[model samples]
Target: MSSQPDLFDRSLLRSRRQRALKAAKPGADFLLKAVSADLEERLLLVNRSFGTAVDLGGHTGLVFKAIEKSGKAGQILRADLHIADPNQSPPDLVCDDALLPFGDQSVDLIVSALALQFVNDLPGTLIQIRRALAPDGLLMATLPGAGTLTELRDSLTRAELEIKGGAAARVLPFADTRDLGSLLQRAGFALPVTDLDTITVRYDNMFALLADLRAMGATSILHDRSRTPLSRQVLYRAAELYAENHADPDGRIRATFALVTLSGWAPHESQQKPLRPGSAKASLAEALGVRERKIRE
Candidate 1:
């Protein structure tokens, strides 16, 4: 087990997710809908079908629905901290994202959408996922990347500094795309790939954006978050700052959501491997049709 302290309040996050599900309104899951479509598109590109697929931390089964619609996998299972609706088809596995329960080489595919970002120990979780996958099994997931919510982060920081004389951690820290790619390699995944897609949403004001975040259960649950509620003055000032800095000509403020997609396969002997350093058949100079200039030691 890692000795490092938890970055997010997982208990709080679970409760917040439950609350959000109870109060969810139409259009509250717009981000999930967009991510689900992207996941389906990516899955469609893969030619082969999977025997058993697990939806890891899939909120409200959007990713599961996507996978089912694609007809790419058989025996789909949903796993989450809690079932969003007991009346509906309950999740097959109710478990935390950080601690997966599966035998070695058990699952053929795992898909997660906008869920792994809140995990306290993402690297460990990735390792566990890799261990749970069959040889050549695939993992595809999407989460908010480093550039997400920059406007709101800046506005909140400035506002808090001006009003409270200091700023606290108001936004959750997101993983960088390169860092996530490196993690896939570290977790022993083969043919790892990471890509970014920026989604910009325009809101009438910062408050509207905040409301949407709350509805999505995406509000900050950082373990070190300030206990005191944000003052109305600070909130209004942040809104004003957001408009001044990130608003469009039409007076609508823009919010950025940087989605980072990750894909990798559990290592297998049949997968492609890189050639040895000196195994190239043709020299670089020959390939480029240029005279090689050696660097002086």
Candidate 2:
């Protein structure tokens, strides 16, 4: 398939996120609070094993709940596209630019949470992540993958097509497990590991789930949003359609989150490299009687 314009673009998605935050403020907060434990576990693991770490796309420090509490790190750098203040500063904060402003391989570990999906130049970003890491440094991050919001998105699209005559843009674009694995390989990481976790939460209604997205500061941020105020007509229509078509039998809505976690090591020169084409003593076909037959067949 052809690559998408902002499919993995972070800046574009980051710009679109504020709207979602505004719309689902309460929900995003609740959702992040809910996932705080899991995120902390991921963070703690990063810290205990690797003393000095850098948090990329480290929005508001939601993921690293225990950073300040621990006396472990010599320093932990918290980086983001935009940060209000360093808060405490030693594990310094820097707003993002086109590239990471750090010396090569200076970081011991890299941690990012729910941030990879927004990157447009994903491979390049991974390469940069690699470059930022010291030899044997670890990179751990999370992103949304397939099966996220399946019910809501599918119902909304169906409802719009049936009544509104056209469908709205996608709520989010997510890669599947296989796609993520391939991306890890392409990024030149050693022993890349990718896995998915399915989290299902029940909501009083559709609005509740939307709220979660807001508090998490993870809402859709398309470059284009019709360029004008969203007409109440569209808004109301969207809500009505969502409720009518997606409501559960118990009157509760279900929101599903598929999170992909990736772990990788920067490539080391000591690792084995594939041999040159003619470096082998003899080709297998030459030793076997089927040599000519293998070539012809």
Candidate 3:
């Protein structure tokens, strides 16, 4: 099989993440912490416990801390592309987004938050993750969906096209809900489920939104991103368009973040499987108390 296309620059991604937490302190990673907390809360609703867990691409250990608090795993290991502060707890493994340093069928659970969207080879990463899981092992992760930053993406494209007579990629691509499910199945995971939640945040202006993205280490890092700096004229026009199109009643602009949550399990004989066709004992018409008409062969 052919290899997956390289989409992101790993070194640049690591630098941005390091810079984002350079002024690190309590609550510095506010947005990441919020999403990690939400993901952990939802994971707990599944009511499953694991003996060993790994938090892949866990920036600043926020998601790992959440996993620790749930008491769902006996031993929790942290992995990421960057090494965290020495004063803080160090990670168990430091590696690239698409690499996994674990034995096959060893981990009982794996959790990632706001990280997989940057992976250059998501299908390969998912396959590695599935291979690392023990039988019936669970994987729970959340990443920004396709609808994230729609307003900004639209505004930027229009402004750049109008000012420069062309446009370069400013926003990175996101995974669609169907694509996530297909990847899980392709990776040989069982009982996969994927869903999305929309979170709308209001910013005073487009600059504020951009700054927040920068602080969160979420700015564009696509491999094909434009090297030249954006012109001030384009930036100003983009801001004006954003405010005009997505402004709230209070004059603040609305930014939409669609978070996609995915859950899947390592294949196991005990897990539920779909029955074969023509095996059902009851008919839909009978169940609904309606007449059933058969077409002549």
Mind giving the per-residue lDDT tens digits that candidate 3 earns over 86-151? Answer: 445778888776878888999999999998999888888999999999999999999998999999
- What is the per-residue lDDT of model 2 for residues 1-297, given as tens digits with 9 covering 90 to 100? 976565434564555554443354433444444444555566565534565777676554665544444433567777765443233333366555336786788887777777677666777888888888888777877778999888777765665666668776547778898888888789778878888888887877666666666556666665543344434565556567666666689777677889888888877786556788889997776788454554456
Better candidate by lDDT, 1 or 3? 1
List model 1 lDDT by residue over 32-89, tens digit each: 9999999999999998899999988887778889999999998899887645554348
Q: In candidate 2, how many Å is residue 187 off?
A: 0.9
TM-scores of the candidates are 0.97, 0.74, 0.95
Q: Rate the local accuracy (lDDT) of all candidates.
A: 0.92, 0.66, 0.87
Please count the clashing residue pairs in each candidate, in the order shown: 0, 17, 0
**Best model number under lDDT:** 1
Candidate number that wins on TM-score, 1 or 2: 1
Worst 10 residues of 3 by lDDT: 80-89
